[model samples]
Target: MYVAVKGGERAIDNAHAWLAEERRGDKAVPELSVPQIREQMALAVNRVMAEGSLYDPDLAALAIKQARGDLIEAIFLIRAYRTTLPRFGGSNPIETETMTCDRRVSATFKDAPGGQVLGPTFDYTHRLLDFKLAADGDVDDAPLGTPHPDATPHIMSFLDQEDLIQSEPQGAETPADLTRTPLELPASRALRLQSLTRGDEGFILGMAYSTQRGYARNHAFVAELRIGAVAVEMDIPELGFAIEIGEITVTESETVNQFQGSKTQPPQFTRGYGLVFGMTERKAISMALVDRALRWKELGEDNVGAPAQDEEFVLYHSDNIQATGFLEHIKLPHYVDFQSELELIRKLRREAQENIMQEAAE
Candidate 1:
């Protein structure tokens, strides 16, 4: 049992005051407004929103500001705030196929349908610091391109038509919400996808990287990586129809893994899918690789004892908020626990010394 210590209320209040003052930084400089953070530090906002499992950009920006740019802290704040929100209902499943593509690229095929549009990417740019941006953050307007008249088709469809890729049949059953319920083992693909989508980007990336480093390696080829705004619709009970509520930017990646053939099944290319909020290409791609690695059992492949293949390990430890909470709790007062440990160690030493003294006397 842990003992409750008192008398730190004044100290705690003073520390919070100091934190607020520190967050403000200087009186001379202008304060960073929520809008500026939402707009300028959009990627950070997106990450917080993704991990927090909340779609409010303003709240994420505010959380970032309140946390003094500490993303994990911002996520924690957003998550805590999220619990109080009332849920009206769930939205219709987003149709990524109809996304207005801002950026689309494929590593597997050259000149795939919906020609590669390198929209707002630093992939080709030299990794040099722009000294001009430091002094003055002004730039000329970027040239615009004509929007595609037709809905950009998914590249996987080409393989699907040929029956070259493993078919993923949609299930009618409603997927369990990880946020609402406790995670159970032997989780469905939908649950895994949900966990991975909101999982820590760094952790997901590391797991994906592990797969590439030959840990249960399934050679994955990026069939398509698309980033765009997708319309969100909600079914209205009164109207008896679904209406467009809003739009959200998302990054989707579909990776084609090496063909897996068994005596029963034909040699067919496998798939790894990832869909995430905002233009988080790296995270999306990483999620795809990890998602594919996790599908070894379903795909009729050997486990190979990979970390990514361990569903329990990946799902349980993926949430940064949970991980940080357990880790950070150690820093708090462990007086009772520590005292017990200290007393035990001292007792052991005394017993050993007494035994030594008895032996010497003998």
Candidate 2:
């Protein structure tokens, strides 16, 4: 019998110290400042903010620097920080129609009311490695987009007006925040959409692609993709009304999907929604498809056993923080259990051999 080795706390502390030192790298080289990281590693900061559900670029940059530019680690840091923040109140849902437009585009419609403004996106830029950026080149704003407080309505809204697509009523109730409480089974649309927004981009993309490949393919079309700043209003119960707390930049995607019509119900294009922090169109689009697939139960459609259709699968595996923590946890020590199994196997084999020898002699 092997004695159980039980020193984990000290070892963990040592490991953390070593990791911190490693993150700093060479002592001679000046440490990368948070501002430098915020400026230079803007994409990393953006990704961390997007995934972590926090928009502070400086804090996100600091998290990035501390994590040695490991975006996942940075995301973990930001999420941890976000958890600690005091929620003074909940914001009234931002009206996307009222957003000060930065970028708004639609693939399904050729011409929309707002005229599809493609603002501040790297979508069309060539994927060339710029070596000049390595020397810490300065970036300056090209031309500022004028704020349009009252922009034209969403293109999909026009389709709804014509009765081409299903019109969804905006609920007056506050949506549940997944971060505060344990995610229960049978999540709401708002909860599912929230999880998908912070979910790993690649995982959601793969799930979305799978749907397109005939795994519960619902025939989806991009209705609208909007990126802009929306006023965040918080309801002050004492004051008797909600006030604009602040403004946040967000990207929202609405995908129109084909739904089966019954004898009683008429055929109308159902919609999938995705609203995410920052200008992440790809993630938002993927999220919309996955969101649509998840709505199988609510829409009274047959479940195709798709990855997105499985609530347990989608909710459990979405966050990279949870996924990475569980994945990397396997690296911890498990020698005691392995040794016990090794001893049992050896004992069993020896006893079998002795019994066989005795039987042969008899």
Q: Give the candidate number with the greatest lDDT.
A: 1
Clashes of 1: 0
Candidate 1: tens digits of C-alpha lDDT, residues 1-362 = 45666978888999999999999999899999999999999999999998899989999999999999999999999999999999999999999889888889999889898788778788999999978777756766778865344588999999999999999988897799888987888999999999998899999999999999999777899999998888999999999999999999899999999965865568999999999888788999999999999988777788899999999999889999999999988988889899999999999999999999999999
Kindly give the stretch of ten consecutive residues in candidate 2 with the minimal lDDT sum.
1-10
- Tell me the spans in candidate 1 whose CA falls farther than 4 Å from its real position: 145-149
Cα TM-score of candidate 2: 0.88
lDDT of 2 by residue, 1-362 (tens): 23445796798899999998998899999888999888766666767888898889889988888888889998999999998898776677788888887888888887777677888778898989867667766555578766556755877878778997766777678777788877887888888888888898888888888888888866799999888889899889899988887888888999998876644447888998888777678888999999989988777788878787898898789889999998987666667878888999999999999999999999
What are the lDDT figures for the candidates, one per model? 0.91, 0.83
Identify the runs in model 2 with alpha carbons over 4 angstroms from their true place.
1-14, 27-30, 139-149, 351-362
TM values, all candidates: 0.97, 0.88
Model 1 TM-score (2 dp):
0.97
Weakest 10 consecutive residues, lDDT, candidate 1? 141-150
